[model samples]
Target: MNIKSVNKLHYLIALIAVFTSIEANAQEEIITVKKDSIIPKKEESKKSEEDRNVMLNAANNTGPREVNIGLPASVGGIMIQENGMPVVHAFWPELPTRTWRQSVSLAKPGLTKLSEVAITQGELGFAVSSETKLGSDTPSYVGNISSSSFGWIKGDVNASGKIAKNLYYTAGIYANYDPQSINFKFTNWADRTQIYRAGLTKKFENGKGKISILYKYSKSASITSHALFRYKLDGKVEEIDGFKIGRDNYMLPNGRFKYLDIKSGEYKWMDAGGRDNESFAHTVDIIGDYKLKNDWNLNYLVRGRYSESVSFNIFPTGMTQATPESGFTVKETGEVYTGSANSMILSYTPRTPLKTFMARAEIKKKTDKHQWRFGLTESLYSVDNFTNNRSFYYQAAEADPRQLVRQGAATGNTDADGFYNYNVGGEHHNGFDNKLAVFGSDTWEISDKFSLSYGLNLRWEKLKGDHYLTPRTPGFTLADGERTKFDHDWFHIGGSISGVYKITPSFGALADFQYTENNGLLTSYSGNVTPNLPKTRSPLMGLGLYYNHPNVSVVTQFSYLTRNNYLTRLNLVNPTNSSQNQVETVYYDIETTGITADIIAKPFKGFQLHYLITYQTPVYKNYNFNAFGNSYTYNNNSVEGISKVLMEIDPSYTYKDFKFWASFRYFSKQYANLTNVLFFAPRWETFGGVNYKINDHFDIGATVVNFLNQRGVRGSISGAELITDPAPYNDRLMVGTFIRPFTVEASINFRF
Candidate 1:
């Protein structure tokens, strides 16, 4: 056998042996591995059942299942798709599951409070979904999961009790931290997102009603993208390339560096700034519930939130490709920006700060034969933001951008006056966009077998917001020819009507016909033309059939989605002057449809298996826009970032506290960019693990991930707009991200 193979085999065998020996020793004691008892029973049966069901679903770690943070199962190894974003038009099984955080509807404020009761009565838990966890030092075990480098996850804790007669109190906290990955294989960034949040909720009831107050704080260090940089031997390289984009190409001076040195080595790569994303958000909320005579209940909520991206003068990282065609010159073998961060920021944001307020009220009536819910919601959103960006010119024509880093390297870019060369060519607009919205919904349980919910929403954009402007660049005055006032008024309507039908406990079907049209500043730029405003309009529908039995579970679903009047922003090289960039706006209409099938089975004792697969077709129906003194049209093309087929398989077994499992994740080959220049090969990863229950109070486990260390290229895809529009309008590229190499991690748990 090859030396490498033999070495791997030895480690694998050693791991398995160590785990088996420990478990065997614990087995001698004859102790059962079960959840610790945490209840002092009263009417606890229902609560216990709910907890068990949630735990079971969590263990599966598949679609619609929420990850519980407090459990050892949450740390790492979460099977995440699209890096860390919600699936577009997903399909689910017949059983009701919380696929994603349900929309926080102000009308159902009380329901949120009631759910917390379960937390207090049970164990503390946080759903670490949509975010990466962290790295580990040991081989993995059966339940340990890996985390994603980017995503929004919620961490929370709750407690409830009776402070006095007819007086009850409840408290909770919700916090989350976005997982930030140190450069993998190289200094190239693929995923770099930072988020910190802490929220406090207090609820205390009196004779009049139940009242709750909430306050939250949020901070974001930055949001950056890993660019697909061109690899060459020389250039005015601003940063040393440590790794290759979307591949396991080791770029450091030495051999492959593991996560071990990452914590200490991460800062060294900061010289090349990715897109800087710094922002803050503050929120305050008040909600209350009151019970009326008979069987009626009412709920009301008032909330206000303020948020803004920190204004900056530098992009730090290049806004686009650093290829020669983009004006950037590097003399080293690494990544550089073709475009300056300053120019990009000018085109992205024209506003300073943003604010929002929401108020809502809901009422419900329940009887033996019928249950009805009705509610209304109103909100206001506004933004006032702008930007200033300049360029730093290089004076040393003798310097090479591609030169690798030198310990004592001295930059020779100082001008005669010891001042830096600063060039100005960016956009600037001073304006405010305010939007008002009102919505209402009704939910009716018509019968035991069928139920449905419907809602309507209205939005008025730029109703009464102030407008102003400055020159696109500093030191330049705007003539009467340049339009600066960006103000307009428009209205939109949206709503949804969805229903469920159940034939039996084991058989059911679901159908949802939903459409939404809204207007707002969900963007960095607030420069809307008075006569031409951008709005978001999306319509989606889905149908599913499921059959559930004691031994086997099966589900099939089909869904269709369309995005029209979607907002598309672009940064373009100014045709009037190649030295600068021109920000452009375009709109496109898109359509997509897909089907998913899943099966979970327990063919025999001590064994379980799950299989899921999906097939999809996403395409751009039409794309026409005018920018840089030219109008262009793109023919129908398969939208980038969407794969035709994907699947996952999980199998596990347990025998008297000794457990083992294997999970497989796979995706078909796909186009990394819309134009299809960058191709992404099909990729898959496998993880094998074993867990040993070392006598009830303590346990240890080990896991081997990507044991084969398949160096497959994989990453998120984007359209040409991410760069300059129409340059390669039909193209797409996979940024810096790849399947990790074969690795092993181990962990232990203690219960008191």
Candidate 2:
């Protein structure tokens, strides 16, 4: 064998040896792996008959089962798709998923969170039904409440039981007060959230059919903040000299903001400190399953949701030198000429009311050697109305920044509140979209040691929208313009093929290949006048191996993916002239290759370690674009906002009824600007928690986030998209988001 092949074989042998040794040493003792409700593995057959019955009962009551397309799983974002559609649309404003129970697999490991939910080409588009536990046959109740050091309180309560023969029900409520709902600091904004949900299940007398109905109501109000920072010469995003990373922001002291109401043609006040952005949503779901003759079964689901939300935000634009010649006067206190820099403040608010409906039906048949499924899915998403408003003013760049009134003629004379009559009104549109797909898959058990699975999905989609084309001028009104219509439709196909081979009972190897194509939805077209958006094509290939032992388990995977026709919007500014700027829409492509290793080990009694490492190279390709008639080409630049290396190490110990765990996550440097000019330094996030079981009915726990006190700046830097050189920005401050500061939370839980 070649040297490289020999090296790989040696490594594999070493891994097996390590795990085998652990298994042999622990054979005298019993080791129980954590039960993951998501994965349905072959080992489940080893469970007891009563356990099997419970599992079957849970499935019969929880509506349709989740759809697995032989893909690798990931975390975060809309990893869970319901009926071939995302439960929450990625392009729209939505609330957090604290109360949402679901899981996700993105066809491959080590994919970025953005790529996980982008709904682009090559994705499996797997369906994971959001089934509530309300219809459980066993009676259970759980409640917990927690308060954070950051002055936030959160609590939840849930109950499930059997009400009558073949009848089950579940109910729950959740609430949070002044929580740090967003990535911004809790001290920067005020927020609240509440959710109420209930479900009922019924079974047929013949035991062959079942149905469940679920309802949910949720309401939330939150604020997102923008913070200013400076870029160091070494390409590090640093907090301003006196500004704190997480404890300080640019919001008004009392959280009050004044802006123009475009529809009413008058100025209005917004309470940024309290419920600045609000959302209300209602959802209803119906699900059914029936067993048919000849070993065939049918499962179906239907869901409808009505939601309305409004978001208001204020952020800073470009910065300029602060001087008397700049003609700056503080509007709030009538002071003049201060600070080393200044920037224009912009306000944006959008109100969206929408309705969505989805349906799916699948028929499955199981034979001695083959299992087959055929399914159909339909989704209808409509935006009843969408309206956005905007306003602009200027502000001094300093802690507790003050609004400035321009006394110079260069910038138009300002009103008493320092308001400028610039782009004060915003666009409006109404959208309607439909998607239909027919899919089929089969799993062939070729032998006890080998199996193959393949699936295909044929899809047809239509997007229709009516937009008001009027410019966002001062005093703009919805009735002042005529609406224009745009309609587009297309057909697409996607499929996946995978196979697994068992080298031994405890060792296995697998490979998967997938390809898919996608296009822009209503949200992508709403901001532009043209209906034609670029289509994207993505293809992914992966190879993996897994080894399981009595005390240790390891999974390693390698993936290569190439996706073209990425879409993004950039706000570009002239390097020599700060006043010369424009917003441009750009299209680019990316090629990524990654490897991941996940390991779980239990070296001794009541002690476990979970470790994961991912290394990836995601680079730009054909990234040529024009801004303000200037052509720029960035062929092999690293993709911005994504780290190349990520690692997670978690260790836990359980003694008696008490448990302790600590987790450490590390991230490599991440580029902040599209031009690859500035970047954020590598950082670490530490979390540790301890829990005590105070009996079968009560438990208490405490956890801390960012326990290492790493006040690092993360995420993309706003207003720096066009900066190719950082020399000019050394003295000027730019705005960027930051990681949460250190905070601790304690909670008590009870169950009956």
Candidate 3:
């Protein structure tokens, strides 16, 4: 044999000998303890503690997951743990991305491998998990910011164990960047999300009771802007620069609205960054439970959370000019002057900071055939959004001998001391809100063939806002009696009923009725004559069938959903030409019908697949709104963000020590305007990964996201008042500003 081959054999032989000796010593210790003991204690042996945290192997693949998915807001149910335990939550914690677990954890921790004696059989338990990952993405739409490719690194470490008799504790730190982040900018995006969690639970051996305490802190800062694109309009390219959403679209006397362009010195509106947004929330949970009477149990839970969202706007260097189509007006003659572009302005807009506090409590019981629950919730919110849309207006040298803006300085830039007297009018809003709700629910398993569940909730809410216009240089100002305010309160009720029937162990059918209520952001900061906005509601009727087998599971549901009360605000010009303009709220209704199907198949060993698809039509049953002195109708139009067809497929395979999986997501084309003319194309994405274990101690993996490098918006919206937005901005896509492009990620796993 060669020298290298001989050395490898020797190494293997030495490892085997060492392990054999350890095993022999372990066996000898156990025998010696038994022979020397007079009375054995009820506690587990010290050996189990020494071996408690075993390195994960081929036995468990789902990883250590204590959190639940598809929480109370979505589809509801119990989540099964890898260790066969149950953790019941009173409600989905009010968190960002709170609807579900973000997705499959990339660092699947070894914590899932705790043995029965270490956790279930003994009173004491312990587990630890930590992981780090780096990811990359290539985005296609680079309108004015960032690059085509970027990368990010994320990490988390968590540990949980029994600290004392009947007491167990858990803590973890989660690090992330950007909202909806599977990946973020290589560097420039400057938005991030960080979260920390700590929890503890104690059980009383004498009374069949338990108590739990949990605390969470989360912070996020996201840059809210879109990567722009183009649309075809009558054989011409109409590259949209801005969305007409919530912010001020100032109109000049000649009926023209102007936005600045930094690169081309063009006069057009654009969705650019002015607000640096930040948000933070802290939560605390305390729960206590006890058994009472025969087949009866009592439980109480209370959760409190405080959160805030901040918006700050700053000026960027740019220039706004007057064009021939939208001419400047002569101050004395009230006549239009169409000429070359010539103007520049420097300005900034700031948003009122929003703060809120919420509390929730619930009492419940679970018996063999019946479940009962009661809950109450209270919330308070306040914000003072003050804005000023003014600038140091200047006259540019390029104008055609006639100044477009007549009143500005004869210079193209701000003065050396940054002092200028010109200022435009601004808007203000001061809002306050209080909300309360009471809810109860019951579920009964009447017989082996059927089960029923029902719930109801009553809610009351109050919103008050004071809105007014600030001073202007030459137009209507607060000093000219241009002030307004509003305030109002409202009440609502919503509930759900569901039932199921079983024909066999593997087959079942179900029906459900749900009534849902929602609202537009409450904008009642400080106001007089506030008209209480009506609540929005959606009542649903659904039916579904399910089949379960050792190798496959399938569920399909169809539903008809009715919608009511969409809130909208419009500006009204006084017929008397008064200084104060009126703002009014308008409402609309819609109807939708849809079908959802989900399937999970493990047709053979080492292979599995999950597929979900939805087909929905959200047509406007009725609608009317006025914008910029024009009225429009949208009856029978499909709702924004509701794609006709949406689908996702995830498939995975395992062979010996290797595993591979891929996820496919699809979205259909849709409109971005009420007229149904502005359209965005369809798109699909592919993401996949592969993992191979080198041995019991180490494994390596790689992931490819947007494998096809596809790009496009996933959801779209026409426009609306975004009270939560830092600045009044509109004309935007929902998520995925051109879906991320193809990029690869590599990682390694070390277990001990």
Candidate 4:
């Protein structure tokens, strides 16, 4: 072997010797204790101390906080960005990508409510699994109802009991409505959300085995929120002259919106917000667990789902103007111009139906010193045809912007129908996608204070579909008549190595490393241009330390991560020429180094404090690309839409039958664009709440969000792509999104 290779091997061996035990084995032992421990002990072990802190966090989850549900808000000191829509990524643009959806979302609704959540692997990015806990031998019923000052209401009820000899059943229903505090008019559907869900499960015993079937139905209306606020050159985000950041939005308050149907070529008005983009789904799961001879076990599951048409509708803010141009005319009145306006894009994706099926099987064997597991998984999904629509219009740049039309010929950009046709075209065709994976893992208990674990996964994925073959830019003359067919398949391998060591009963260390790969989804084909299908390589490494004491506990971790072959499509504006723009496809890489520390302390009875801080630098590398026949470079720039520092402190106190708690979260400034010249300043979000238990079966609570009443802006700059220098646009207005306003929520819980 070469000298460098030998040195690397020696370095790895040294690391393994330093951190001897594997985190995977440590996790397995911890979970076993949580499930099998029958007696409560007064003294705390290192594991018990960690568990206690977890329980404390769960018990204190009473306050109002930002709830995006299925959308990516923040994670690992960064916010996930949605730069393009590809079917293989997420059914919904804002949701987690396909590989992450199963872990991040409870799309099946009842799955989470009826199971015990668990993480079986040291690296969460590798896998997250849950164990179903329905149909307990004992009969039980639970229910809760909540109402908030902002016209939000939510309720759920669940019941489980034995129905027959060796048979049990569970049933539950949940419903909720959110008024969206940041937007105007609670009565309107703009930015509103409503959900209804019901589920039933049956479990029965067979010879030497147990089987369960679960069925769930869910219906939901979730709206997209995008608004306009001013971004200054000095890194200050300010509300427009007549607009309020939290109380105003670009959407119409009456739940009315108009757009031309691409297929019909006729204007139609639909309720704004999620009303025009509702979804319904039905799912069934069959699960089985069998005990085998020789210390072996077998587990299998089959899941099927059918979903009704689901759509996406949003009015994303665009270019802004201090005053309307001369020919600007009100669409409703057909009169002349005058007011300042913000150019807006009305983008719509019509509903498409879907069907999916998944099956998995796993076998496990246990020995005196080792545990081994092998698994196979197969998943298939089919989607119907869909189209993408893009229409443009001007709106008064105020609190509640009103649509305006520029006077032009019917054959020109702006039509007599009152809007400019940016591009309305077919995006996706009916197609099927499939994935198959085989995995294996082993954990070895090496000694009293050390363990080792390793795992490997091989996955085969295929995307078969056709896309509309039309250029997507404005002024393109070709119609959407041609189609591009794609049948692409990829094979990827991933592996993880982790070790944990206990220095003392109350102190421990951990080390982990993982490598994975990803490719574009079927929907990526919709870009008209042939999408890049290169495998994106991602590698992560982490080192951590934990300390535990009766009154205090701390956990700190240092992580380094790198990912290459990131594919994105950007609409770029020339920095040297404001009027010149182009749409380009680019590939880049990102490297992130970070540190996170979590500390919990209970100095006295009934009072506790928990603090968490994360500092990360996620920056672009080798970000050179060509657009409009010109080469550009953006190396060493900060990744857009992510803050470098995040911190939260939560404190709670209990006295008699009342408990009071509060949380404060801080985020550092974040870059607004890829070029990194514009940014939004740091901001804080605060929440506090109190709960009172009136009786064994009754409890009431109230929470206040944004208690400090700080108004701030966040997320990316709406349409300022590739604007390296902000000087020329200083005089012109710019738009972005803002945080929600102060709000309050209350709830009541009951048990029997």
What is the lDDT for 21 in model 3? 7
Each candidate: what lDDT? 0.38, 0.59, 0.41, 0.55
Candidate 2 regions with alpha-carbon error over 4 angstroms:
1-85, 95-129, 181-189, 235-242, 258-268, 274-276, 340-347, 409-414, 421-425, 468-482, 579-581
Top model by lDDT, which number?
A: 2
Relative to the true structure, candidate 2 has a C-alpha RMSD (angstroms) of: 9.7
Backbone clashes in candidate 4 total: 11
Best by TM-score: 2
Q: Between candidates 2 and 3, which one is better according to TM-score?
A: 2
User: Ten residues in a row with the worst lDDT in model 4?
Assistant: 23-32
RMSD of 1: 15.3
Q: Give lDDT tens digits, candidate 2, residues 323-431.
A: 6676778776777765644444444454467788888787888788877877887778888666555555666676676667776656445677766654433545678
Instruction: Write candidate 3's Cα lDDT for 661-747 as tens digits.
Output: 887766566554344554455666666878898987567787676677554442332122111221212232121123444556565
C-alpha TM-scores of all predictions: 0.59, 0.83, 0.60, 0.81
Candidates sorted by lDDT, best first: 2, 4, 3, 1
Q: What are the per-model numbers of colliding residue pairs? A: 55, 2, 22, 11
* Per-residue C-alpha lDDT of model 4 across residues 294-323, encoded as one tens digit per residue: 878987878777766544544444453323
TM-score ranking from best candidate downward: 2, 4, 3, 1
Q: What overall lDDT, based on C-alpha atoms, would model 3 receive against the true structure?
A: 0.41
Whose lDDT is higher: candidate 1's or candidate 3's?
A: 3
In order, what is each prediction's RMSD in angstroms?
A: 15.3, 9.7, 18.3, 8.8
